[model samples]
Target: MRRVPDVRPPALRPAAVLPGPAPRRGPVTVALAGAEFGWGSSGKLSAVLSALRERARLPLRFVGLASGLGRPLLAEHSVEHWYDLPDAAADRRAAVGRIVRSHGVRAAVVVLDGAIATALQAAGVPTVFVDSLPFLWTEGDRAALPLDATVYCAQQCVGLPPECEGILASVASLRWVEAVIGTPPAGSTGTPGTPGTRTWRKALVSLGGLGAPRLPDRTAYPRVVVPAVLDALAEHGVQEAHLAGNLPAGLLGGLVERPPAGLRVTAGPLPHSAFLSELTRCDVLLASPGLTTLLEAGRLGVPTVCLPPQNLSQIFNGRFHSRAVGVDVRVVWPENVFREEEALGLRAKGEDHALELIYGGIGRVAARADGTPGAAGLRAAVLAAVRRAAGGADWGALTAAVGTGGAAQVAEALLAIAGPTPARGA
Candidate 1:
């Protein structure tokens, strides 16, 4: 008997051996945000989002909130919608609640934006909070953070000074991670320098933390640091360089005003990948010591000189860089400007008190463009540090000390909590 093969396309592709929760009916939407103060938070979010894209089980859509200075930074990523941070503090909760509900956000990933993270959690969305500056927090900042987040990923630092004691431990679901940085593409690694013979062909100077809201004048750091770095790069035989950051519009002309003979200097902000690409190709990197940039450059084996810290975290970052490299690869603010010890000491009082000294000192130095002793001292230090980096010493220790697998670790945590709730479809 010709039993017409009982084929209904093999029972419509045989039923699942075990029934699963109907395989997420639609793309899962996730909320993303970074602290508005600087690019550090956004950079961290970029790395994590990149990692999540790789690891996510279902198709994903991203919506952003309150990523102010960072909104443009994530331009190339896949964020489908963006909402400015609520203009009024009073509206924060309601605004965020509306966003979560409207977007159908199954989960959220917030980098250092505690207020938003807390708000999303209150709206009944699980959140994975990345705290890149766990060591920068104190009692004063406790109220701003959601320590009991579903997953609190605190970047493990070189040391968790006495001042930051318990800040990390207090997180209800704290997970310590290595540097959460994105992997650069192939051929981005730096060349190993020869002590006497190497000539830096290209130097990339990255200045982050430039748009910190509290500082009305964004030019202070760049005004003092740019020319000094350009000159130093020229002295070290660098033929060309690029300065990347959120520099003020009119500042570009001044940054390139006086490049050393035969040295071509260009200055402007770069997208995250673009900046990292430049970092990997350059012979040396001079940057405002933001941890994310330092970690990115370090992973590429790029010779990095911490251009004196721009804010609280940077001070510690510069010190950590030096401690890890076992060399002071930092160009510091002159002691007359403000001692690192003194600023750090003030943290016991509160970050604002410390920031007062830092901001005022930088402002004072920036005002001293006439080559006053303090300003000249700063210029000399930057020159010396970049010069040292050009000599081809091992500067990868900092990255090695703080491993670079953090982005994946963070992604894993986020995915775990991102599971659909009983109320929502799986």
Candidate 2:
């Protein structure tokens, strides 16, 4: 394995520096600006915020910029303040500035939202940007924010721009998950039914939040694919499966009401801790190529099969991370999946050309899983991949490459930028 590059910024150059043991003297407020894209970003932000609150041992306040899809989750996590980002740049900046001033926010952690980071930095609040997909980073993205620090939560370093100060750490989701699930026992190789044992019995299925409101209804994919996938798993001797994601409760209920025979299926949205704990118990993970889910499954050494992703970033993340870890995650592209009405609805959302291009591209890729041949091929491929992963993929080496203590390391960096805690009253 190649040596993990040292990408720490000069300011954070102290080797093995962890969050200081000293607790803050008084109340401190730090804003976490998370992207409105999916559960992955907000879920991660929530985990890190929780860690900072616990480790700092201070009366902390969390403020959030909630995306339409992310609002409920943010509310669920109890973010003290929530604001909907305005349409105009000036309006957005003004809104963020107002919040920072009103809350007296000392620092901010911007998760994948560069524009918000720029606004907070301009307001003179210390800021750190968490770049979950380093591969997606661009010079333009950095120029817009130019944050004080950039932390990459990835397995391998994909060299960032020379001008950008960067820190590479293990996937934050994995660190958070392990913190909750506890580490797997030493020398515990493979999940259940590795070679000598019976065929794999448990599977966890999840497609993270759709993230796009104008696209097809949430039930579209589940209505068509869940039965088939469950049936296939059951035929392969898989006895039980758990389905979890940001899907509506009604859709989950629809699936549970009519599950395939011989295969028990339970579905719901799980809290971060519960979700990770459950991942550790599953034999295989079937999920969208969200970086958080992928890394958590990889960390726990669970076999993973990635479904056709809704966007290009997910596709790239799935391919890049899978190869980096030597895990042959099969990507099953479903053909003819999007209905005409769904396509039109997405186009009508006012970003016509871009949406058309994206939808067209995804449609082409998804078309690959159109027939019995495609479906059977995917099922067989997933089974083989699961067997290989369960038998043992160099998970130790992968985790070592990523390193650990991500949340604390990031919290330390943020605190450093925030400067010394204020002195308490005499």
Candidate 3:
């Protein structure tokens, strides 16, 4: 087995043109919010907030209404103006209204949380709600009224509660398309096309979102699975396996000290943008079935092999992305990857499993480059929808209609309604 040197020779490609630095945009304020809730909720909410910040091309200000759990991480990108949550839900609504009116906001974009949606809707503000997780609720059930428009990431709401209703506007990623498109080219793997040093030539592994248990069987699953993946890759005659995502220090240090004969693992959390950039260079990815990572892999055109955690959410996510998107990949129990009936006893089941895995792997890799489906098309479509609703006039209606663009669209709508920056706020 051959190992890729930890270093690579620089690839002599033409320097990719960098977009001119993000222009500072305005006093047109919108809140990037989350329930001042738990870590899981905040992390999910932040992914949406980050996407909104990425798409806004014009000068703008973001006010965060929840706590700083997600905000501080975002401080490097732009100054976020946050509002404290009021004691009651009613007070929270009134507070948000005051903030919007004071800042002259035309739109409030909610990244598909029930509590956040309820607050903005109660305030009677025009809003664009980008619902990435349909399993949360159906559009009508979730939003009740015909929202100016709604956008969803998954195909129509399947597991959604009875309440959601709205036309399907677009499939948007919780991920920032800009993050993937802006990745720098990686240096070459000096080891050439040689097979890897261990049996596993190329391996990518991750435990999504801080290594918290994603499935019921998760606690012991990783312990059993990672070693199996390493062993299988070793058997396949690959040299090195790369580990990515949240890894505990003690366990990681232990792995490093003794180390698998030829395997190498890098530990520590990477800056979000940097991690996706590095993703361009990976051969295959192994991770818990998180929509964010799976979508990222799809965009990068990387083949993935997954072991679904035994939790309902992880199971649903794994099944959905694999079967629906028709990506080429494998999603199986750990036992399946190593079991041997040789061929006869479990022939049909084994064949079906192999086909699904291989098909998903090859299919997703062939789908498209990450971030290729530009948001411009959606923006144009949204503007048209808002215009028709407005009878070709500028009104606050556009805010409700443009759901996916979030900050950028809201800023545009505000420009249409409130006009340019004026003297000082009253």
- Which of the numbered candidates is closest to the native, going by highest lDDT? 1
| Model 1: colliding residue pairs | none
User: 237-270 in candidate 1: lDDT tens per residue?
Assistant: 7898988887787989877977789899887788
TM, every model = 0.90, 0.74, 0.53
lDDT: worst 10-residue window of model 1: 5-14
Tens-digit lDDT track for model 2 on 1-426? 133365433323323233446564766778887675667776667556655665554566677764556555445465777777886889988988888899888888876676887788778787766666554433334444343433322323432333222222222221111111122334444332223333678999987746554444455445445655676677777889998887777777867777767888888877666677787778777787787776666567666766655554565555655675566655545444433334323432233333454555454443455523245665665565555555545443333345444555566566656655576662
Best candidate (score: TM-score): 1
Q: Of the pair 2 and 3, which is ahead by lDDT?
A: 2
Say which prediction, candidate 2 or candidate 3, comes out ahead on TM-score.
Answer: 2
- The C-alpha lDDT values of all candidates are 0.77, 0.58, 0.41
lDDT of 3 at 67: 45
**Over 4 Å off in model 3, which ranges?**
1-26, 34-58, 65-76, 81-106, 135-202, 209-242, 246-258, 324-328, 334-423
Q: How well does candidate 2 match the true structure in TM-score terms?
A: 0.74
Residue 133 of model 3 has an lDDT of 46
Model 2, runs deviating above 4 Å: 1-25, 71-78, 138-198, 213-225, 324-327, 334-358, 361-384, 387-392, 395-397, 421-426
Report the number of clashing residue pairs per model. 0, 3, 45
Is 1 or 3 the stronger prediction by lDDT?
1
